[model samples]
Target: MMDAHKLDCEAAESDCRFIVQSEDEGEAIKLARTHMHEVHGREVGDDELREEYLQVV
Candidate 1:
């Protein structure tokens, strides 16, 4: 069976910290990362100019 508590924690982390909202954190992380790259010109999500996107969901 799936672990409810684990999923809840992961969901919250993947959503709040990263400003990412999705039914799938894996996909969401990739999306957020990609957006970070295109919009910020930083593939590693480390744009100090926009440090807000410097995190993976």
Candidate 2:
């Protein structure tokens, strides 16, 4: 079975409550980054996203 990875925006910032989960960490981060850019109008880097947003589950 694939291990699940998660990204919870609420964990990083209380005002933004976005959550994304996927079997692959790369996929989760891609979705989270897109969400941040499209929805929040913030372009976040991959390194920063992985460091701040990604959580292995």
Candidate 3:
């Protein structure tokens, strides 16, 4: 089994310290995108999440 995929909001250079981890990368990205939009007012996309925030752990 592989480790869960991880994403940290701090990676996007935001002051918000949001972090998400899941076996499903899609889920992580979804949660991150939602958090960014609701809290930070940014509509982040999958490519940007994969490139800027996604981390393999």
Q: Which candidate should be chosen as best, given lDDT against the real structure?
A: 2
- TM-score of each candidate? 0.41, 0.83, 0.88
TM-score of 2: 0.83
Candidate 1 vs candidate 3, TM-score winner: 3
RMSD of each: 9.2, 1.3, 1.2
Q: Give the CA lDDT, 0 to 100, for residue 55 in model 3.
A: 91
Best by TM-score: 3
State the displacement of the C-alpha of residue 30, model 3, in Å, after optimal TM-score superposition.
Answer: 0.5
Question: How would you encode candidate 3's per-residue C-alpha lDDT over 1-57 as one tens digit per residue?
Answer: 977989888877557688899999889989988988998888989999898779989
TM-score of 1: 0.41
In angstroms, the error of model 2 at 19 is 0.8
Instruction: For model 2, give the 10-residue run with minimal summed lDDT.
Output: 9-18
The segments of candidate 2 whose C-alpha lies over 4 angstroms from its true place after superposition are: none
lDDT of 3 at 36: 87
lDDT of 3 at 30: 91
